[model samples]
Target: MPMLKYLIIILNDASVSFCHYESAKTGKKEAGMISYDNLNKAVAFALKNNLKVNFLYPRFRPGKKYEKLIEDVEHVKIVPRKLGGVYSDAITVLEAGDLRKENKVTGTENIILRLSSPELKILPAAVKEIARKGGRINLVIKDVENFGDSKISEYRKLLAEISGLLIKKSGENSIPEVNFLTDRLMLESMNNCDAGITHLTVAPDGRLYLCPAFYYESGENSIGEIRNEINIKNRQLLELKYSPVCRICDAYQCRRCVFLNWKLTGELNTPSRQQCRMSHAEREASGNMLEELKKKNFKGAKGIEIKKLGYDDPFEIAVKNRYSIQEFKNFNS
Candidate 1:
């Protein structure tokens, strides 16, 4: 049996976004206290499974009763550090204010900054300050479903503006890494969000979910009780091979989100055209960013060669590759 090595438990209403893109409107009620009975039970489950647990927090205060439980467990909180004192890698909820003044992130923490179309265009300024902080930055686009061929050119131009800053750092021997345009260049294979494959999430109700959003979007989607045994149907569908667009895709940086897949396509296995094109634009941007660095005599990253791809969507190429999508599933199975 394949064992789950990581477990995520949500404790509050306003959990941290971490490195993932969070939906602006999550239809969840306030983060109520799970009976200490349940919290202890969940921790015991993690201890028995040999899993690492990361706890999620809300903006509202956690009662004193919950403090000792927090101290006892090994978990990370995702909250907005700038609002006051709540810390532990704040999720940059929006990009509306002075990038540096609004977010003077300490040098040793991680940040998840979410941006819409207009906000992303102004990312060059934020990227420079973030790189100077000596911490990692992940840029999450809010409206990927809106990206199409008409907007592809605009996205590429924005990447050029950001890449110019990144390439200049090469001269300084600085590794200013940005998720949208740089991560793909360095990843050896797929770094997709391992939703149902490797880990599971436990909601405040003490039920297991594929990830947080699934638990919040519709309560009925909960997988199973986390204490005794866990069960899932169509488990293979969560793997890369079952995804037609992602299986043939080389944009290893894309999340290939399972919840987003269900939301857009109604089928967990199918990927939307918008998602594929947006990721391809990102992949192409990284390719161009690499070319800019090479002019300054910047060598390659690791052993992975990021070959320039001709088309943005791999499904288009899958039509031409002798090994169709059917063959991919066969090999993985």
Candidate 2:
């Protein structure tokens, strides 16, 4: 297995979600805090493995005792916007409703903006706000599982408008780092989540999970206990080469969330239509933005190219261009 580079420690069952899945609504009984003993073991495990830790915080503080344990290591904090005043340096998550209030955002803070399909209409304005007051904005569509043909079309149109705004911002020398658009411009290869591949999660139960989403789904999904050797069944399925569509895809910035894959398609390596179409929409919008930037002679846009694709969904391409067994073996070799 590949060496783990990062470990996500979910501080509590009620931890605020900074990603697609909601931690508070997992329907699981409150498992309370990760015991101080397990917490120490987790930290020791991380230190021994030379892994970077990311502490996910809940709405309320974890108290001074937990705070002290967290401060012992150099780590990143992912917290909800409600606690932004407390952990000011943390990567803060703001839901669609949060944007309605008068929230103060410093231009140096990394923000994760979570939105559903209906809330996507506010994205353009949100982008403008972030460009004016934040560092980077990671847009996480909360209901990606519900994205259909019509919603995907609407998302594409919104992305086009967002691309135009980003182009304008670039010309003004104040380009905001919107992950959906800006990330695709610079990524040359697959920059996916790679949950079980590059990083793993340690839930409050002191067990290892592929990622936080898996742990939230079920403790039964844990690969192993944090104190034991990590073992992930069918682990190769998490790699890029094992993915039929993703291996040949160029949506380099797509999260390729494996949890969503298993939930929607019943396979770890296969992606749902919603995921593929949405990623390609971002890729297409990025390509258009890159062209506009090049046309405007934006110096920073030099050397980046997002090529055009014939289809929005990679499954369509994969179906039409199926590889033979020998071809697959050669490709992997």
Best by lDDT: 2
Off by over 4 Å in 2: 25-31, 103-108, 171-174, 324-333
Worst 10 residues of 2 by lDDT: 24-33
- Candidate 2 has which clashing residue pairs, if any? none
Candidate 1, residue 227: Cα displacement in angstroms equals: 2.6
- Across 1-333, the per-residue lDDT of candidate 2 in tens digits comes to 356798899888887787878786442323567877777888888888888899988777887888898888878988887787776568888887787776434323578888899988888887887777646889899999888888988988999999888887775334678999999877777888889978889888888899999988888898988865777889989987789989889899899999999999999999999999999999999898888888787666556778888888999988899867876677640
Residue-pair clashes, model 1: 2
In candidate 2, position 312 carries an lDDT of: 89
lDDT of candidate 1 over 75-180, digit per residue (tens): 6655544433554433434333435465544433356667667666557777787677665678777677777777777888888888887777654344687887
Worst 10 residues of 1 by lDDT: 89-98
TM-score of 2: 0.93
